[model samples]
Target chain A: MSERYLFRGNHAIAEGAMRAGCRFFAGYPITPQNEIPEYFSARMPDYGGVFLQTESEIAAINMLFGASAAGVRAMTTSSSPGISLMQEGISYSCGADLPMVIANVVRGGPGLGNIAPAQSDYFQATRGGGHGDYRTPVLAPNSVQEMFEFPKLAFELAERYRTPVIILADGLLGQMIEPLEYTFDPVDPKTLPKKDYILDGCKGRERRVIRSYDLRPGYLEKLNFERIKKYQKIEAEEVRYETDHLDDAEFVIIAYGTCSRVAKAAVRLARNNGVKMGLLRPITLWPFPKKMIEELTGKTRLFIVVEMSMGQMIEDVELVVKGKAPVRLIPHPGGGIPTAREIWERFQQFREEL
Target chain B: MRKVYHRPEGLTDTLMRYCPGCGHGIIHRIIAELLVELNIRERTVGIAPVGCSVFADEYFNCDMIQPAHGRGPAVATGLKRANPDLIVFSYQGDGDLAAIGTAEIVHAAARNENFTVIFVNNAIYGMTGGQLAPTTLPNMVSTTTPRGRNTKLAGNPIRVCELLNSLDGPVYINRTSVHTPQWVLKTKKAIKRGFEIQMAKKGFALIEVLSMCPTNWRMSPIESSRWIEEVMSKYYELKLFRDLTKEEK
Candidate 1:
């Protein structure tokens, strides 16, 4: 394992996927994340992996569907608008019960908004960006190290659940450079679970058919119920978050990804000024750390929700809070990261109100 | 007991849900028979499109995938790239391949991906109850074109074989039909050849089968076959459009 190497967040994700036994990569070029495909385009061949700069985001995700269906580790990376184009394929993958990784290096958008980092896609990511009764484990990575680590983590979760997993990152995290250490050896594909469902030519066995179209009266209901059970299991086992200085704290600021990193700095400054602020960062946003937040409802008097969107995650926070405590939103809108000083000012306002 | 005929091992015992006298049943049998003959059933993957053949996976005894409408080629590309030893093919209807999946099929051919495509051109959106398709002939009436297809507004039928021939990626590209016993045998042979090319690890291979849609065409099965020969085949002629392997020889 190397101690350190200069890597962009996107490149770290690409390297992590390759080491995680991703044998196929297909993606379309989109901003702040273009380096991911470019890295794979150069490195995959050296490892005997397949890399395709697909014609469109739709094609890329479909390629992932095909590769994953064939019982190989596969992935694709895109930003907000590109991810929207892939929802159909994403839903299809979930229905087909294929395991794969997808990274949304999110940028601002309701449409083709600027390529700057923004958390506006939190709703789209955590709420099944694709259609149907399915949920993808969404992992939010704040540091370049987590960016390197989450892809591998995403693959394991995807394989364990036989479902897709999403690495919900934003542009600033994607474009930023950091020193990363390779702490793991590359995964050996041969050691992966036997995919009896893979389409590997049915010569020595009964033919395996992987499909999602169950048109019978109660067939879909049965399948959807099974999917719900799987989601329930994931919810029970995969809730992840980090707490900072929460012991004896009166005010807590909740955020994730790049915004959480900013909130951490703001909390530090607020604590220096005796404002008693702590930071709670959600690492897995899909199976959100609801219990942790619910625990704070009575213990903490005020909870601050900071984000790069118009109060998207605040809804989830409120659901967990259950009106036990007052909550305020500090929105940074889209296209830019919120400053720590701005967050500290908000903490001051909340402290004065208290 | 000298068995003169029986179902191939590549097919399940389950009866298909296709309409009576549909060409899909015949085509399905052809593919199944060939998979057994080639002994590639276990290592073969088929991508099903979102048309009537979306249920093709139900009939095939091999591993199968049903992708979104018109995205079979892209899915096939991924499968083939992931495991070069696997025999991959996509089964697509006219609307699925020509209308919505144009980019996927075109780029797949352009990439020279080593796989086969079973393109079924029924000239109407069969599964959707006879809507006009990209291959619908001029003056042909469909639900969407109640007054007959107006070439001025709807454009002429696209000749998929000729269109793909313009690309150098495909190692083999052919068009055949299942209207008559003679054409049915020919289409089967073309399909077999397409599979052989795929087994050889040659580039993309496509076999377009001009099929009959009796229910969608508002005619008996017999009339539908006649219509295919007289109308559809006239515009989409049966022939081998390209064979790059031949050029290499």
Candidate 2:
């Protein structure tokens, strides 16, 4: 049995990145995620990795761009406001087809809104947060174990797709501590397959160039079309979700991240009270489990979308459901977490009305 | 018969899109020649900034990355720190290095990042048309400053070498021009020295090249070169502000 150790979500993320062979990390300090950079600063040197406390979040993301272009697994962590500052670099990484990982420990936001846990950035993560036409694959981790294990998966998806990957978490998850075990042995970067497109040097080969712009007319359009096909491929292959009693579930609660954990408890409460409620937790928020939701729509009478914000993920749920069933939202905007008892009571009320 | 002149292997065959008599071509040629002369062509990784030299990734015959506007220094720091064996340089324009990316450049210098920076100060935003630049000379006429730059309104031109020379992290900081043939040779020498310092793992080194922008300045090629020597050089003095090698010697 793997030995279990108590770890905070933020520190686990840093440790998981190091174990995943991330040799470069640059990030600015922000609330709920300060421990990430602090942990990396103290531990990375021992692992022969580089850690940089950058001037701003913009510099951190741009640094990731450079490190990723040089064929190194790199990561950066920031909060809501800081993540907003990093959009430009993230868009550039997408345009240039460079691979990198970014973790956004969400806090209440609209502008320095507060350091309380919130899921207001769901729309920004699923849709391309930055300008231009692109989508960054997003992974929503709810548990401390998922926080520790997601960085390795995020890096794999980033390199496999040659695009930026976002690990979307909230302050509640980042601050929570739990016992966790390593899911796999630490990776040795030297043993990894060599990437052909890295810009380490042009020795014994033709020189390579990595750029986002195509000045020639119609060239950028062509590139965009090719990238869209890659997105489609990912949608087909990378959709991931967890189902709880979904087979016989007449009512479903759809949620993710911290809210999903609450919804899971609410589902258990409803089941104990002789209600046929189920929970569907989405892991990959970008290649969202659209097929599973559509399949569930046939058997489900109603869907309750519980979120820490004002109904952001509900839009995706509604789109997938296609108005076949009614969807209701239990929104607690601005750092409010819905209690399991409250959710169960609301479901009972809605059922009584039905 | 011996050939006296040939194209340097450091540059690609892609034709530069710069306007005629533009200083970018001249500066590009100098960097290419130095890359070959130093024999670090294969191991060098150049960063192209978003300005007139945005296409530098195509021109520089080495592994290159074109990052976002004004982010060259941060990118270079990452590349150099991640792999110490790789030779990295960031080629930037005035708007990129001084105006928008000031923090990146200053912090990189403060860290004494072991890399080379080629800052081209043409006194105008060449790529975005004739707008004002951070290094624009006082009372100089630009599109934004049509009636000439007012020192009180627009602020004074930044003396980049002098500003950076005050920092202890930088091992070498020099300002050179590429207008006259003598100054062009001197600019090449200063840039070469900057790369040499990086090769020796000394510290951060910057070579500020006061270049010509004939199209943006709306002047003839000869007049543009003459303007750089007579007018621009007065505000930005052509001299070495800091040289650790010379200090030690």
Instruction: For model 1, state the Cα shift of residue B208 in Å.
Output: 0.5
Worst 10 residues of 1 chain B by lDDT: B226-235
Across all models, the iRMS values in order are 1.0, 0.6
Q: Name the regions of candidate 2 deviating beyond 4 angstroms.
A: none
DockQ of each: 0.84, 0.88
Tens-digit lDDT string for candidate 2 (B1-249):
999987789999998899987899889999999999999999999999999999999999999999999999999988898888999999999999999999999999989999999999999999999899999888888999999999899998887888888788999999998898898899899999999999999989999999999999999999999998888898889898889978887
Candidate 2 residue-wise lDDT, A1-354, digit = tens: 989999999999999999999999999999988999999999999889899999999999999998888888999999999999999999999999999999999999889998999999988889989999999999999999999999999999999999999999999999999999999889888989999999888999999999999989999999999999999999999988998888889999999999899999999998998989999999999999999999999989989999999989999999999999989889988888899999998887877776
For model 1, the docking class works out as: high
lDDT of 1 at B241: 87
Model 1: residues with Cα > 4 Å off, grouped in runs: B1-3
Model 2's C-alpha root-mean-square deviation from the true structure amounts to: 1.0
